[model samples]
Target: MKTRKKILVACGTAIATSTVVARKIEEELEKRGIAVETTQCKASEVPSKAEGHDLIVATTFVSGAGDIPVIQTVSFLTGVGIEADIDRIISYIEGA
Candidate 1:
């Protein structure tokens, strides 16, 4: 069996916005048969909370994520270019 992917979903507040992004990522990836675990954090917390995660998805600028792949976008909130973003994330999973 394949291991579940760990995704760190971050935004400015780490509350409402991050929740939305995390939930959407979980829902979308599950439909594609990809198991994922998402943890929400503030962008400022990213450097400290980013370890052990496979990927970082943020709605704002984030750094200190080390070598983990980071996808910075507002697509989830905007409802635009979402498919392309998801595809990009899927590509990372495939490569992993």
Candidate 2:
């Protein structure tokens, strides 16, 4: 069987909108049968929190932190960049 992919979702704050974005990512990933682990954290904490994760996703800009692949995107609520962002994440995880 294929291994499940682990993902980290982080934001500038660990409340409200960040939580919502994390949930949306979890839901979307789960629908595809991909295993995801999400955490809402301050943007500054993302690099540290991303340890052992296959991918790190941030709602805001973050740099020079985790060694894993990272995706920087806006909230999914905007519905503008979500699909492309998600596709990039999945492709990265799938080693595409």
Candidate 3:
């Protein structure tokens, strides 16, 4: 496994929503024994901020993620499909 996986968590404002998402992702990844480094950003900034990151998890739609995998979800806020999202994240990390 990679030493650390870099993740970009994006939301409409990059503050409240992204922070929650980032925290959840960090906890989930850590439970799987994967070290994670996360950066929070606005959805509009994803194109630039997503560079060099392993994955993008956003509550809002993100465009121009380039080659990085983007998992668009509101599960972090709604408490639904959170497990599926985590599974997808793990898949991306393992595959990478």
Candidate 4:
């Protein structure tokens, strides 16, 4: 079986906005049959919380994420360039 990709979806509060973005990412990845485990957390927690994550998708800037690929985007909520963002996520999954 293929291993699932671990994703970190972070925002300010890790509630409302992150929830929406995480759901969208889950749906998109599910459609592509790319299994993923998403963890929601505050952007501020990303540095420590992103230890084993394959990717970091955040609604705000997140520094100190080490070598993790951080995609700072709000398009999932704004409905703008969302596909591009998803494509980026897919690329990472594909590369992995």
Candidate 5:
């Protein structure tokens, strides 16, 4: 069986918008039968929290440090460009 991909979703703040983004990604990935684990975190913790995850998704541009693949997108909450961006991220993870 294939292992589920773990993802870290982060923004400047964790409460307000990052939670929404994380939920959306979870829902979308589930619909495609891709099991994913999402953790909402502050942007500053992304580098540390991303360990062991398949991807790190940030709502804003992240600078410095992280070995895993990263997807920079703010649309996960706004619902704009979310589908396409998420699709690309998923494809990259799967293809890799």
Candidate 6:
């Protein structure tokens, strides 16, 4: 396994929503003994910013992630199905 995974967390803007999602991803993954480094970016920036990242978690729609995996969901903010999403995120990272 990689020592640390890179996750791109994006929302409508680069600030508020991404912060919340990034923190949630980090915390949940840490609890599972997975370490992650997160970058917060605007949804519009995903295509340009996704190259180096292991996974992309977006609160809004995003395309152009290429070979990297992308999970677009708002469950982190809505507090619904977040556990499943975390597991999904882990699967992608572990597979990578």
| Global lDDT of each candidate | 0.92, 0.75, 0.89, 0.90, 0.79, 0.91
Q: Write down the lDDT that model 1 would get.
A: 0.92
Stretches of candidate 1 above 4 Å error?
none
lDDT (Cα, tens digit) per residue for candidate 1, span 1-96? 878888999999998999999998888888988888899999999999999988999999999999999999999999998899999889987776
- Candidate 1's displacement at residue 59, Å, is 0.3
lDDT of 5 by residue, 1-96 (tens): 887777878789888778888888888888888878788888888767777777788888775435777888878777789889878878866875
Tell me how candidate 3 scores on lDDT. 0.89
Instruction: Please give, for residues 1-96, the per-residue lDDT of candidate 6 as tens digits.
Output: 546889999899888999999998889888988889999999889889999998999999988888888899999999999999998998999888
- Model 2, residue 69: displacement in angstroms? 1.6
lDDT for each residue of candidate 2 in 1-96, tens digit (9 for 90 to 100): 776677777677767667888888878877878766676777788766777777777778876554788777774868787778777878988882
> TM-scores of all models?
0.96, 0.81, 0.93, 0.95, 0.87, 0.94
* Models sorted by TM-score, best on top: 1, 4, 6, 3, 5, 2
Better of 1 and 2 by TM-score: 1
> Candidate 5 overall Cα lDDT vs. reference?
0.79
Q: List the candidate 6 regions with Cα displacement exceeding 4 Å.
A: none
Task: Rate residue 11 of model 2 by lDDT.
Answer: 72
- Clashes per candidate (backbone, < 3 Å): 0, 0, 0, 0, 0, 0
Clash pairs, model 5 backbone:
none
Candidate number with the higher TM-score (3 or 5): 3
Q: Residue 89: error of model 6 in Å?
A: 0.6
What does candidate 4 score on TM?
0.95
**Best model per lDDT:** 1
Cα lDDT of model 3 by residue, 2-37, tens digit: 478788999999879999989988887788787789
